[model samples]
Target: MISGNRSKAWRIISWVIASVLILPIFIMLGSGLSATTELFSHLWDTVLPTYVLNTLSLALIVAILSSLFGVTCAALITQTNIKAKNTLRWLLMLPLAMPAYLVAYLYTDLFDYAGPVQRFLRTTFNWNSPNDYWFFDIRTLFGAGVVISLVLFPYIYMLTRTAFEQQDQNLHRASRLLGLTTFQSFYKVGLPLARPAIVIAISLVLMETLADFATVQYFAVNTLTTAVYDTWLGYGDLSTANALASLLMLMVFLVVLFEQKARMNQRHQSNRPITSSHEIILTLPQQILASVFCWSLVILGFLLPLGLLVLMAIEYASLEQIDELVSTGFNSIELAVYTATIATIIALVLVLYKRLHKDKLKALPINVSGFGYAIPGTVLAMAMLATFGPLDNYINDLAANVGIEEPGLILSGTIFAIVFAFVVRFSAIANGTISGGVEQISASIDLAPPSLGVGRLKGILTVHIPLLKSSIFIAWLLVFVEAMKELPAVLLLRPFNFDTLSTQIYQLISDERLEQGAIGAILIVAFGLIPIIWLNRNEDKA
Candidate 1:
């Protein structure tokens, strides 16, 4: 690698950009710390304990359920001779595209007393009054846990399945020679090997369960996410909201740190010798049971909710609704475009610099940007307001002192804050995608360029960009999809009277009018599929 004035320029620019992106978090921390103890005392006396307990319980319950469902399904598919596993393999991942909040709404409507299940139960049982029979309520914390777990179990399933598939068969042969049975081998040998993957997957589930807002909010569970929204938007108390956001960020950061540490120390090196895997031949009873169990999750998590949404759309579709949906769709796409483009550009620059630059601190920019991914969107939105509100005030004061017109809320009162917050939250996606692509590019390309007297900048422009075209497109599409579905961040950061598809759908959810916005919800779910499908296709090609 060659270093010169050009390298120095990029080094400075990289640090500046990374620092600017991370500045909001520091501002939020300052705001939270500046709050008087009176605010803390009030929150502690009223709702803080409830928020923490609900959040912890939700994460714990979801993690346990997801692990159980995912490990069983993965074992059925990978460790046993199950029927229709090829179909099951891809079907298992379909739930990833379904949002948890949508699942909550659909299932609530399906299982409530006013819904078909309960009504049918009451009618069939000849129950005239409430004491006649027992029925489960779908609006409680337990219900929220079940709905979120259904869609999230796929993370564990996918990772554990891959680990099970790739486990060295030699280990199983030794276990069998030592008189261990099939189930015994799985428990003693295979399960231990897949533990790291399972831990990582569970950590992901915990992070997502913590990030969820609409689902818990709809159920009135009072997690930190809803607390932030209620404190700021409902009560107009920014200081307490910032403090709660800071605590949430702290929790997410701890999870991220654990995952990173475990990942670094993981012992499953791919360099190990490959061996064929053994699939257990199942009896008829086992086969039937496994098939029923796996498909039940698929149907409940994806097919049922999706089918319900479609039915609602068909029954309620109208021109007036379509017109409003189109307008909201445009707003979502516009926000996605802005956020994706900026995030992708920053990711590309930072990733390329790390790969090409000859500096000990080349990793700093990427390390900084990746931290944002673990943060929940509501926290990020609070961070944005905390940072930009003061910046806007400073600019307005300066303008007045200089006898120029005051620019009120130019930064905080517009879509700029929303887009910027989204970029900060999602920049890690683009960074990871492009970084993987950059690694695939041969080092010889850079070596050959300098020998031909090509400057580094020209070589990057002419050579690197061309090679990274596919990755750039993929990164941009992922960020776009994420921004479109993002709820809490846009809901908090969007200007007055401005609505994206997410915020509008949330409004419909708040008012119990989801049927009217079913078409838009479908659109959001459909948009979410692009990145997942694309990632699968890329994985297939590789």
Candidate 2:
């Protein structure tokens, strides 16, 4: 495949791009590991411990609760004769589109003491004092956990549901022959098979929980993500912030390790046909309970918050808000376009290199470049500053030496930085999508292209690109939506007076006035639903 000069150049270009993508991460780690002794001592003496403890606690609680929600819902939908099972399956996944932070803000409005719920209760009981009743504090760490679980549990539900569906029916049959009740047979034979997938899914939940910033920050529940953001933007200490980011990365590293270990330990493959499986028959009461549980998850996770946003938007909508949404919506769309295009191009380059390059070792660039998906935006923001800050200085010095005006923060404080960060963070989505499409194309097609006198780039444009058009579109759509909803990195990296939909919503949230941005919030939510709709369609086809 690497028979000519052009192929060799492609391989070189692929490696260079991969290096650039990972360069920020390496710089962040260097900054963290090379921190001043005083900074280390001060951090170790204060704040760091609290951040670590909060992060660990939040991750554990979210993971456990999300697992419970995911497992129970998966079992009910796939293994029982539950009411509305078909609708419940897709409804459960809608929450994944609702960003946890948005849910947090909306729920806080609904459940806050001054919100309608409390006002109604107070009027109903004719009691106006705090002692009149008790309400759960929606701003507490536990509250943050539950809000996160609502959005994140679907990760576990989707994966575990697939795992449950793929289990060998003969195992269930054997258990039934042993006189086990339907429920008992599933409990003993089914769950054990799904355990590894469940563990891996929970690990994904924990990783996302650890990476969360806007949700915990709004709730005043400080985790490592919020800490890193605060340390940089609040304290104006880049080194300390990078150190915290490094620490967060360590936690994520452990999660990745755990996921890998679970994957390696997986032993649940079965030869049985998935369609041959039996769904357990639920009693009337059990069916009712199951229906209520699944429906509640959908309501709280996606529908209720969405309805509230729509109401707020309707009640408070104005020409000014519409104008602002237009401006920020354009910003968001422009940013997502730039990010998706560049990341997709990078993904295509690297993936094609792996497939066509003679040296198998060239494939390493794909993994290296895609690593940023595992990184939190807050961490990536710190890394970007750590990397680009120095580069900006060098560029300024060079410009001054050449008798030209210094361009302050040309790379670090411009839209370029924001686009670069988005590409780094979301390239994995593009890579995975493109790789799937590329894998589906038979090797014989590559030979056909060459037999037709098509060279490397020509072959890609004529044969591969045509075949991959759908995948490229899907990849672009995924990255675009993710870039639109991404908050922390843009919150840090956006230039003065710049606001995308997410950053604008976060601003209103921080000011305790999400209603002002309700239109913007709903717009973001609507964009998030595009991917979910696509997934539902694909699942139906499957």
TM for every model, in the order presented, reads: 0.97, 0.97
Cα RMSDs, all models: 1.5, 1.6
Task: Provide the global lDDT of candidate 2 against the true structure.
Answer: 0.89
Candidate 1 is scored at a TM of 0.97
* Every candidate's lDDT: 0.88, 0.89
lDDT of 2 by residue, 1-542 (tens): 42342466777898899999999999999998876768767877987788789889999889989998999999998888898888888999999888898999888888898889889999999987989788779898889999999999999999999998888788889889999988898899889888899999998898789889999998998888988888787878898889889999999989988998999988745654544677788888888888888999999999999999999999999999999899999999999999999999999998888887776687799999988988898999888899998999999999999999999999999989889999999999999999999999998877776777767678889888999999999999999999999988899999998999998898898898898899889888888899989999999999
Question: How well is each residue in 24-108 modelled by candidate 1, as lDDT tens digits?
Answer: 9988988988866786788899889999999999998898999999999999988888999878888888898898989998998
- Regions more than 4 Å wrong, model 1: 2-6, 269-272
Instruction: Give the worst 10-residue stretch by lDDT in candidate 1.
Output: 1-10
* lDDT (Cα, 0-100) at 477 in candidate 2: 96
- TM-score, cand. 2 vs. native: 0.97
